[model samples]
Every structure is written in C-alpha cells, then in structure tokens.
Target: MSGTSPSVAAGAGQLPGTGRTAVVTGASSGIGAATARRLAAEGFDVVVGARRLNRLEALAASIGGRALPLDVTEPASVAAFTAALDRVDVLVNNAGGAFDAAPVAEADLDSWARTYEVNVLGTVRLTKALLPKLRASGAGDVLFVGSTAGLVSYEGGASYTAAKHGVHTLAETLRLELCGEPVRVIETAPGMVRTEEFSLNRTGSQERADAVYRGVREPLVAEDVADCIAWALTRPHHVNVDLLVVRPRAQAAQHKVHRDPPDRTAAR
Candidate 1:
C-alpha cells in the first residue's frame, strides 16, 4: 500500500504487490504455487512462503518471485514473513491442507489439532500479522483457498471438515469486519481438484494418493482454480465477489461425482 513502486505509488495508492509487493503462503505447490506465478506474471513482486525451502526456492526462481521459508504453525515464522515483506497488495492465504481421515471413533487429538493449526490458525496468524501492510496499501486483495469440504461433510473427514468450516467462518467474518477498508476479502472454495500434490501432501503417500483418484474423471486442476482467482482479482475495484465455489462439471458436491471409465478395449 505504502511503497514507491513507480506505478500505483503515484496514484491513489497502488495495490500491495502491483509492480512491488505480494505475499503468498503455502506456495510450494498446487494452488498456492499457481497463484504466486499468476501474480508474478501480473507484474507483482511476489513473496512465497512454505516449509520447504528447496521447493520454494525453485518455484521462486522459476517465476522471479522471492521465497521465504515459512512454517505457518509457528508464531516466529509468521512474524518473520510479515517482517520480510515491505508492502503487500495481495495476500493469498492458500497454505492449508486436509489432515487425517479416520472416523470420529478412531480419531487422534494430535492429527485433529494439527489440522486446525495449519488451516485455521495458520491463516488467522498470517492475516492478522499482515493487516497493517494491507491497510497501508490502498488496494489490497486477500484470497483464501477454502474447500467444498468446508461447506459439506464427507465420511471419515470430520477433522478436515471442521477445520475447513472454521476457515469459512473466518472468511465471512473478515468480509464483514473489513467492510469500509480499501481491502477486499475473497474465499475461493472448490470441490475435488486433480492436484496430485494435494493428496500426496495430505497422506504422505504417492501411491495411496493416486489410488484415491484412480478412477475419478474430470477433476478440477490447479490452473482452473488459478484462473478463477485471477478473474476475481482483476475485477473492477468497486466489486468484491466475496465467496466463489467452483467445481468440475462432473462434480455436483463434495460427495457427488461422475466418472467415465478409461477405454481398455479401445487399446485393442
């Protein structure tokens, strides 16, 4: 907001990252990574955050964005991310994931707590820490990558569901709370996506992750979701499309899907 970017720096304040500053968390892979690339391509100087420095470095180098090794679960790391950025125009809080899939009867407290720590608390911590910069910048946009899981429940996904629900609540409250500010808050909730890294990161098993989507057809991809985010961000300054839920044509809800079997006989 308050920077000498030579672009919005002359007008009625520039967007946080417009030719200057943007901060994207959970940017190692998937939506976060895509958003960072999209923002950089949009001419924002993007800062990427994640626990994996190597991945972060590679992504940042490839896109010409800066990388900050951030573990959102830690207060110190969040503070550091905030300290590292000069002024942020867009804050994409996309650093979250699905954790554990055991039934309530067999759930462990550790996995449950970790889910909140990353999804809910991680977002809250980073958002609060960067509010000043967002407010300082005249036109800042904050996009949270929520899920349909936050809206609907799936079997054996109680922890992830509840945590996602918390995120949904957070986004709604922020939208109302920041009503008069120049900042815009948007929640992009998508149904099942074909991001291979999402499943692998959630389960820590590539084989298992592939098996989960082995037969699924027409799942949403990372760029598809990124396209939606880019569209929301480039909208008129007076418009705020607060909550957007996107799913593949085959997906009706979290529990609904249509799959076309691969052609085995066609190979013959």
Candidate 2:
C-alpha cells in the first residue's frame, strides 16, 4: 500500500527493500514453501507459519527465515503469531485443504466442519489478527490462496467448495473496504495443483489419494501456482491483479479432466 512493490511479467521480481518483510501462512510446504523461498531470495525477511513445527522449522531454517506455530483454526495460535510479528509487508494466506472422496449423501458433518474451520475461518482469523501490522507496514498486502472450487462447484467437494466461496467473498469485501486505505486484498484460485500432501491429506488415506489423480496428464504443480503467487504479490502499487484463476492445461474446470484412454489389451 505504501512503500515497495514488481515487474511487467513479475519475472524481474518485486521492488528492492532490504527490510521487505512477509508473513506466509501454511508455509511448511507446497505453494507456501515456494513463495517463502522466492521472497527470501529477493532479500526480504520472511516469517513462516504452520501447525507442523518440524516441517515449518525446517522450511524456515532452509530459507533462513523465522518460523511461527500457527493453526488458522485456532484463535490463540493466530493471535500469538501476529502479535509477535512486526513490519509485515506481505501476508500470504495459503492454508486451505479439500477433502477428496466423500459423497454428499454420506458426508460427515464433523469433517465438513473441520474443513470450514481451517479453510475459511482460518484465513479470516489470521488476516484480521495481522491487519494492524499489515496496515502499519504501509505497503499492506493481503493475499488469499483460494481455489477454483470457489468459482466452480464439483462432486465430493461440498464443504471445501463452500469454504473457498467464502474466501472469494472475503477477499472481495476486504478489497472494497480497504481500498480507501493503503491495504490491498487479492485472491488467487488454483485449479488442480499436485502438491505433496494434498491428495493424502485431503482423502485421509494414501491409497485413495493416488486414485484421485489417476491418469490425469500433467497436473498443475505447486510451483505453477507458487510462481503465480510470487508474480501476483510483486505487482506495482496501483496494479492489483485482484483475482487470478490457475489450473492445469488438461483441466478446463473443477471436476473436469482430460484422461487418457484405457490400455485395453494390457488391463484386466
């Protein structure tokens, strides 16, 4: 909002600031990890947040950044995280998950609630907690890693989709509300990103996880979305991408994929 900002294609990177500080939630892995690295390489002080202490710490150590324990679902955790941080230039809320295989009729409310808790409330909790620091930093930027599910609903993603929709709405509202101020709110919706733990974590089973992406060609990699994020966050002061949708070339929309034909002779 105030101090520094990026390039025409963001290939050149963001503005130079020795004190460029950023707080990235869900920074333990995937897009978060990639972004943290990108920012660190750019000379910014980075703070990585996540529930997995070992992973978070390792990531933080690897990037030479600070690590903070944060669970978006927990207020105390979020509060502690933000309270300790100062001079926040960028906020990357990349903490959301999708449950892969539960049918709507057999949906478990408990799991569904957990999904909402971490996906929607988690982002809200962390964002609100850090607003003061973000605002004070002058160049306050809040970026949410929403999903294409928010834009398009699909099978077996009831709760996840709902939470993402909430994220979309939140980003929109915050953009309008914070427009008068220095703060900038933006959201990126990724289609199907093949991250390390996404499938296993989402399905709650390793075997089932493998089946989710069975035979889908060239799924979107975490770096793909991470690169988009790096590019998006580095935009100039007056230029806000606002909303970006990124997905695999093979996938046109949520729940739709271009699969290869079966090997009839080799298969059972």
Candidate 3:
C-alpha cells in the first residue's frame, strides 16, 4: 500500500539501482553478459553466473562485479549458486538456448527435452530459489529473456517455441500470483536477435546459422535486448512492465521479414 520515496524515484540524483544487487544467469556471453554489463553501468552491484567460469570471471572483472559458476539445468549447481548469494534485488533469467530447428513431424525428442530443461525448467529452478531474496529486497525485479517464438509458432521451431511458450506463461502466472507483492515479474521477448552463439548453437552449423540472418539490415543485438531489460528494471518500483516485445526494423512479424536483393546489397 506504499510507494517509492522521492530520493529513489526517477530523476533522483542517485540512480534508482544504486546499492542494489543484480544476479544475471548464463552471463558468460551474449544477452546475459550484455545485460550484466548494462546493469552494472546503471549502478547495480552485478553478479554474473554461468557454467563457463573463465568467461564469467573475465566479464565480472571487467565490470567490477563478481562471478560464480552456475548451471541452471543441474539442481546441485542451482542450489550452490543460490546459496552463494547473500542478497539479490534483481534476477535476470537468461540462461536458455534452442538446440535444434527441426519441424514438429521430425522432432528430436532429445532436443525437445534439452530445450525444455534449460529454458523452462532451469528458469523456474533459479527463480524459485531466489524468490525469497527478491521479496526481501523490497523493490525487486525478475526479468525473463524470452523470444518471439514464445508468442507464435514458426516452421522448424516447435522445440524452442514450446519451451519459450512455457517461459511466457510462467512469467504471466507469477505476475498474477504475486499481485500484491513488491516483486515485479517482467518478460522481454526479442525477435531476430543476432547474438554470437544463439543461432550457431540452434542450427548446429555456422553456415546454417548465417543463413538464418542472411538478408535485410541490422538485427537486434544482445545490447539492444540488454537495454530493454535495464530500462524495465530501472522504472519506479510500482510501475511493472509486464511484457516488452522487441524486433529488428526489417522484421515485421514472425513470418514477415524484409530482405534486400542480394545484388543490390552487394552493390551498396
């Protein structure tokens, strides 16, 4: 029944995120790493976590934050990661990836299971483990790095789409369940993001991954998504950004993409 104080409100001399701790999962590279860096610049004490301790440590050092090893798909890893944190004001659930792009008829059950385990189950595991800390922070944020695949179905994308759909619904359900709580549940669904390993990991080949974004102009990069995440998290505690959908200018929809002619592009 209370609201944010003027000193902590937007336009205050001190940044809204100052003194708070933000935890970003899958932060070794790509969006997670970008979000962690952006949040640190926004004045939050950042903690970067991922299975890659080397990368995480390097990133954490560059940003003047801390790094810890975390594999959300493993329960023991999740437990250890959660136990290591003393306080968490923000949780960015970005430790997810698509394994394959096969069609539903030719679905790889192993791929489907892996997709679900990382994107859906892993997110849930970390979120559930950190809810208490989030609630305790008084003004907490839980942001999910979702994909446009969650909003619609696409050919050869059922496995990833299904898992992202689960993530979308999970955010919705948590928001409803935490109606009166101080914690905010937010989801940022990005379309056609050109990250380093996302498509490469999904398609299993550099050529196939390159083909996924061969045309048009600039696609959304990890920094673009990270900007959205930081903006949403920095708003006044009472203002909850429920969902944000971002896409490249060349992308009109899941099925509608504007690609320039190859010859014209080459000429330019």
Best model number under lDDT: 3
Q: How accurate is candidate 3 locally (lDDT)?
A: 0.90
For TM-score, candidate 2 versus 3, the one ahead is 3
**Candidate 2 total steric clashes:** 2
Off by over 4 Å in 1: 1-17, 262-268
C-alpha lDDT of residue 16 in model 2: 45
How many clashing residue pairs appear in each of the predictions shown? 5, 2, 0
lDDT of 3 by residue, 43-138 (tens): 889999999999999999999999999999999999999999999999999999999988888999999999999999999999999999999988
What is the per-residue lDDT of model 1 for residues 1-268, given as tens digits with 9 covering 90 to 100? Answer: 1112233332345542355477888888888888888777666788999999999999999999899999989999988878878888888889888767789999988989999999999999999999899888888788898999899988888999999999999999999999999899999998888785878767778897876665566578887888787677766656787889999888877777766565732333
Give the top-scoring candidate (TM-score). Answer: 3
Over 4 Å off in model 3, which ranges?
Answer: 1-11
Compared with the true structure, what per-residue lDDT tens digits does model 2 show for residues 37-97?
Answer: 8778666688999989899888888989999898889888887887788678889999888
lDDT of each: 0.82, 0.80, 0.90
Off by over 4 Å in 2: 1-18, 262-268
Each prediction's RMSD over C-alphas, in Å, is 4.5, 4.1, 3.3
lDDT of 1: 0.82
Model 1 vs. true fold: TM = 0.89
